[model samples]
Target: MSKLLGLGIAATGLAHFAAPAAFEPVTKLAFADDIRNWTYRNGATELAIGLAIAAAPTRKAGFAGLAVYAAWLGKRVLARR
Candidate 1:
């Protein structure tokens, strides 16, 4: 289950890099400039967390990190409305 979740998150991260334009709106929520850099940074963060979650030794910490990240993103999205 952990592996599956990790892979899913990682795939999304990869998608961010593959199609950063699609993520620009979300990036705009936190940044007014250099959106591409922010997008890449976010992608890197997700990639790291996903890799951590996939690794047994770091799975717990990764899940915790993911929870926090998700909550933060949710807040940002809501704040935009």
Candidate 2:
């Protein structure tokens, strides 16, 4: 389980970093001109949480990351709802 978690988190973090940067003019402008801000921010944070979870050496770390993820995901869902 630990192995899988570590790999998954590391992979996602690498992927996130490897991906191209957002070419748009304003990341903060999404609220006014685009819907990208909310979506992108949530996606970015989830990856961070994934990295956090993967780096965790114990179940406690996983749980903490999961809690953070839930909170972030919940906010995104609520925003769209």
Candidate 3:
């Protein structure tokens, strides 16, 4: 009974956390030189992969996704400087 209760709570927590940000609003920025714009192009990809990992059920897949994301971020950071 305790195990089932724990599982239910954990599952509910995960579901709420995994839910899309319902209150956030998207706005268009007009600046062309904004570094965020460039970062968005690069970081968006890694962010997606990280989310994919976070949502993955298996540890191996999640870790693999994290590794890929780290490598990608490292490459970008090194390239900038």
Candidate 4:
């Protein structure tokens, strides 16, 4: 489960760097016209989180971080709706 979640998050993080435009809509929610920069930042963040989660030594902290991150993102997305 940890591996799966970590891989999923990492994959999306890579996507952010590989195709930042794909995240413009979500990034636009907070960054407005500066979506690209925010996308890269978010990608880096996700990559770190994913790596932490994948590593046995940091799984606990990673899950906690992911919980907070997920809630924050959910709130933002919901607020937009």
Error of 2 at 36 (Å): 7.3
TM-score of each: 0.80, 0.47, 0.36, 0.81
lDDT of 2 by residue, 1-81 (tens): 765675576555444445524423322333334545444554565566566565655546765876876775566556654
Winning candidate number (lDDT): 1
Model 1 segments more than 4 A misplaced: 74-81
> What would the per-residue lDDT of candidate 4 be over residues 1-81, giving only the tens digit for each residue?
898888788888889999998988878885555679889988988988898898889988888888998788777667766
lDDT of 3: 0.42
Kindly indicate the candidate among 2 and 3 with the higher lDDT: 2
Q: In the order shown, what is each candidate's alpha-carbon RMSD?
A: 1.9, 5.5, 9.8, 1.9
Clashing pairs in 1: none
The parts of candidate 3 lying over 4 Å away from their true place are 1-56
Name the Cα RMSD for model 3: 9.8
* Candidate number with the higher lDDT (3 or 4): 4
Candidate 1 or 4, higher TM-score? 4
lDDT of each: 0.87, 0.54, 0.42, 0.84
Model 4 stretches with alpha carbons more than 4 Å out: 75-81
Report the lDDT tens digits of candidate 3 across residue range 1-81. Answer: 433433443443343335423211110122224444443443344344444444435435545755775576566556555
- How much is the lDDT of residue 7 in candidate 3? 44
